[model samples]
Target chain A: GAGVSQSPRYKVAKRGQDVALRCDPISGHVSLFWYQQALGQGPEFLTYFQNEAQLDKSGLPSDRFFAERPEGSVSTLKIQRTQQEDSAVYLCASSLSPPHMYMNTEAFFGQGTRLTVV
Target chain B: SQQGEEDPQALSIQEGENATMNCSYKTSINNLQWYRQNSGRGLVHLILIRSNEREKHSGRLRVTLDTSKKSSSLLITASRAADTASYFCATDVEAYKYIFGTGTRLKVLA
Candidate 1:
């Protein structure tokens, strides 16, 4: 794909329901990131991946929020027992280089999946 | 907590006018980037200024960084209705982690 792609542009789930969001980053991109954007707020870092390695999960809000990139290509973010506060846009971004490089590389973003927990 | 803070949460301007937004951060940074978002979906990278660079230009967009002050500003010249969107400034404090500001909502009226 020419850009990062996310599946199910919108999802509405009942409170306590589990939901999964997927992201397919640009081919061979070494770095991928997941962020959550609340209404009227900027994107908040959720997790990061360097290939299949989940290098950072510190941003994940709670134990219910989990992300994985097992094969280093496609990634999934799963939220267990969703709450109303969990309603927000989930964004995915991929960069050509890793953060350690300190390179001014551009990060391509996907048209985020909007999750609405009812 | 977000490291960066953008000023003027929202601005409305007529087309052809210039739009300027400012961002301030708390700590040292490796680089600062500007991004634009439309309809509150994806964000498009606009420009980036490294810690060593003071200014950068991309077509009609001009970005300036003041590492000493820990601040950056973005200037969009001759804006259009299509330019109406949310503008955010992100600071890279460490490898791969980008701390983003709340953002400025720009509305360029035609």
Candidate 2:
């Protein structure tokens, strides 16, 4: 794909079940970020990976949330023991630069995965 | 954690009218960007204004950053029904990490 791609546009998980969301960033992009957005609220930063290195994971809400980008291409966000509060839209964005290093640093985003915990 | 706080949580205006939204942040930012999100969709980058820069314009969108007040505002001129969406400000505090504001929902009636 030419742009960021995310799979499972819609996912409904039973409470306590585990769910994994996938993201494929733009090819050759140096930065990838994950965010969680609740109903009527803005996105909250979750984790960030500069290529294959996970530099920041401070925004992960809990130990149950795990994200990885092993080869620095594809990324995955996994939630263990899904709860109602975990139900939200998971967004993935890819930028061409690594932080504040570029003149034009706007990020390209995927349609996002809308997760529902029932 | 969220850094920017947008004002006028919701706004309504007629088509062809101008709409404005504001955002305030707490920390120093390397750059500030605006994004638009329609209902049930991901965010779309609108504009990016560097800290050293004061204002920027892209099409009908005009963005201003007042670093002294730690605030930014987005103005949409000649808004259309298609322009109805939620606008959010994302502040780049350090690296690729961006903290987004609560957003302002704009409704353009035709």
Candidate 3:
């Protein structure tokens, strides 16, 4: 598919466990973003990557949340010692141009990975 | 910490009626975008309005931005059942970062 792709559409894990989610952004995209959406709520920004560099992670709720986009293509979000509050749909999106450009291009989104903590 | 907040958390309207949802932000923004999300699905971009632009339209979707009030409104004309979904407003304050509103759950009854 030409759009962004996310791995493991659904995941279930016990509390205090660890999990990793993967995202494959559109080829040649310069900016990628990760968002978390709780049940019946809007998607909240989690982190952003401009190529291999993590530009911003201010939205990350805690240090337990980590994300990396090594080599500037595929990205991974890892949650260490996942808590019930960490359970939500993780969405990956990519835009063709860098955010600073201030272009009107829209970002493409993936199906997202839903994580459930028991 | 959310920058944008939407009004009428939930709205119900008959199909063919126009639906309007409003969003307000706390700070200055470069651009504001609207997105739709179906149940259990990722968000799909609907429209983007820059701070300098007051209005934009895409097919049946119309967006108006009031920078003076730090607000924006999305109007969907001739709504359909397929339009039933959650609508959110996101403000782009900086590069690659978007602060989203709580969202408005719109239910278009057929």
Candidate 4:
């Protein structure tokens, strides 16, 4: 089975520019998650979607960060007015089931989009 | 705020030896998961242990959890050079968000 896939493995953007990163989850996956990883740091939660419903967006750092998964198969994380602080690797993951009672289920990940804001 | 923290930010060991990493969290969690990541790559799920499980083994990997202490440890025995990577622990907080630890960089010399 194909793993999760993301586009634009590397992106270099100027400060104040807008950037959009794409994520294609595995077929039939019901849950998707987004995270941001700074240099030499662990990934920080961004947002979550379940079958087209954005269940949680609390993890989004600010209003400049937005995400959507209208059809529930593919998702896009968009950053408006990107800042140098936004420079980091953006990761996407998917799981066959929800992380509620089946919390231990593994979540497959993509190589991630490394965005560099200058 | 971060929920989990891994100790010994970096470690170096010889192949065929054992490598151990520990993680601690500040809140209650439904489960804990361990992930491995190569440099310039995404994370790979290594194992997951529910709150009720005390220990689990996958091949040469061993994971143990202590809910009372809100801590977990991952142990790899007879490590190979290929085992060198960054190890991170994530917690399923309130069954919604997966909070990851700072991670430990392990280097195995062959």
Looking at candidate 1 chain A, the ten consecutive residues that score lowest on lDDT are A97-106
As for candidate 2, its clashing pairs are: A99-B95
Supply candidate 1's per-residue lDDT for A99. 72
Provide DockQ values for all models, in the order shown.
0.78, 0.80, 0.75, 0.81
* Alpha carbon lDDT of each predicted model: 0.93, 0.93, 0.91, 0.94
- Candidate 2 Cα misplacement greater than 4 A, ranges: none
**TM accuracy, model 4:** 0.98
Stretches of model 4 off by over 4 angstroms after superposition: none
- Report the Cα lDDT for residue A93, model 2: 95
lDDT of 4 by residue, B2-97 (tens): 758898899999999999999999998888999999999999999999988999999999999999999999999999999999999999875758
lDDT of each residue in B2-107, candidate 3, tens digit only: 7588988999999999999999998888889999999888889999888889999999999999999999999999999999999999998775778889999999
Q: Show where candidate 3 strays beyond 4 Å.
A: none
What TM-score, over all chains together, does every model reach?
A: 0.98, 0.97, 0.97, 0.98
Between candidates 2 and 3, the one scoring higher on lDDT is: 2
lDDT of 3 by residue, A6-94 (tens): 99999999999999999999999988999998887778899989899998999899999999998999999999999999989999999
lDDT of 1: 0.93
Q: State each candidate's clash count.
A: 0, 1, 0, 0
Tell me each candidate's i-RMS in Å. Answer: 1.4, 1.2, 1.4, 1.1
